[model samples]
Target: MSATDDVDRSSWLSGYSDTVEALPIELQRNFTLIRQLDDSAQELMDDVASKSLCLMNQKTVLSPKERQQRLANIGSLLNEVLKRGEEKFALAKSTYDTVDRHCTKLDMDLQKYEDEQLIGPTMGRPSTGTSTAGSDKRPEKEEHKRKKRKQTRGRKKGIAPEVDEGQQQGEYLSAEDAKQHAQSAISLSNLPIDPNEPLYCYCQQVSFGEMVACDNDECEIEWFHLECVGLRTPPKGKWYCKNCAELLKIKQKK
Candidate 1:
């Protein structure tokens, strides 16, 4: 909600490779073609049925030569229907093959980008279904490793942590602190009772859903719920806690 990566979601999507955007549109066109083929085939079958009924009628007297000509017309119509169906089937197969190739490349590209993000100075921040590349969802573990800061027993006071110098957005965050935040970034829903504490965010609810971590090293309350700050979707890049965002704005205006 409040905290967002430097690059906005729209901007990131716009800059993606051509295939990423085009493949969806292309797939839709293919589906439409398939539907059209179905309708056309049904209409042709109705035409054949109507002609067959006419030939079967005994009330009308027909010369041998005329009867033979009617039979020929029916045979040609049936052949036409078969030809049309075969052509449509071939086109559909080709369309699916193209889609398969595009997806395979997209998978490789996303995997490489995700691997790169895990290294270097920004290492150890757990992503919560948010990234500019829009990679595949990270696999959910049946059980997440439980690691929490020591805290006193009770319903959390629902108090905001003290704002230190490091609480500023995109400011100093020690590597060790980043690692700690990443390790503790489990789904709030799965956070066990007693040892774990939830002292930050305006809602001040215990781990109940997906969470994102502020990069700030000294942030007393480092983790925040994605929903608490009004974010329907995760931020495109690095997300800071609400306090850090406000602090950053004040500093900017100054």
Candidate 2:
């Protein structure tokens, strides 16, 4: 047993077979560097789980700094919905150019009312009447010879032709003497001392019966039945009319 302990036990078994012959290569190279660091840590955990499931199926969920503040609030709501749709298409093209300039000024006012009703010389008259200007017709005898030379120069200037209601019925008065001469000229304008019987004159009874006169402009004033001025009932305190209470007492004595 002692040859030096059999040469130290064959040199320790030849240095343990040379350390088991370098372990496999070192264990493949450390297991290929730990399988390339586990495929880079599973590709950085699949890029952080696909950006956290794209911020949890988004609609608006965000967090990576709130998805950059929800992408800057969706780019300011698409620039305020494209500036309110370009201001409603420029106000619908300025209301279609103001309704095409009011339909070209109503087609030039309907062609000037059809050229003033076809230059009318009694245009198309037939209202069931006699009129050929009263008819002996040579253009109604030249329009009664130019209306008898303008009514003989308006009766040589005294101008009496406007006599309508059977010639102004003797100038005026006669609606029961113009309501008794407008109640004798509103009781001779002594203003309202009339305890119920004043004011006198206001006529116009059929054909030309007029007479009107009151504030003494030479006496003819008369016409009373506007229910005799209590104006058909309301009276209690503020009564008025007697020529507006004598012009409001001459405007409160001036």
Question: For candidate 1, what is the lDDT?
Answer: 0.58
lDDT of 1 by residue, 197-242 (tens): 3365554556544455565555557666654554444444456676
lDDT score of residue 231 within candidate 2: 30
Counted clashes in each candidate structure? 2, 15
lDDT of each: 0.58, 0.45
Which digits, one per residue and each the tens of the lDDT, describe model 2 over residues 70-130?
5555555555545545555454444444444444545565565444433343446674345
Clashes (candidate 1): 2
Task: Tell me which residue pairs clash in candidate 1.
Answer: 188-207, 188-208
RMSD of 2: 49.8
For each candidate in turn, the TM-score is 0.39, 0.21
Top of the candidates by lDDT: 1
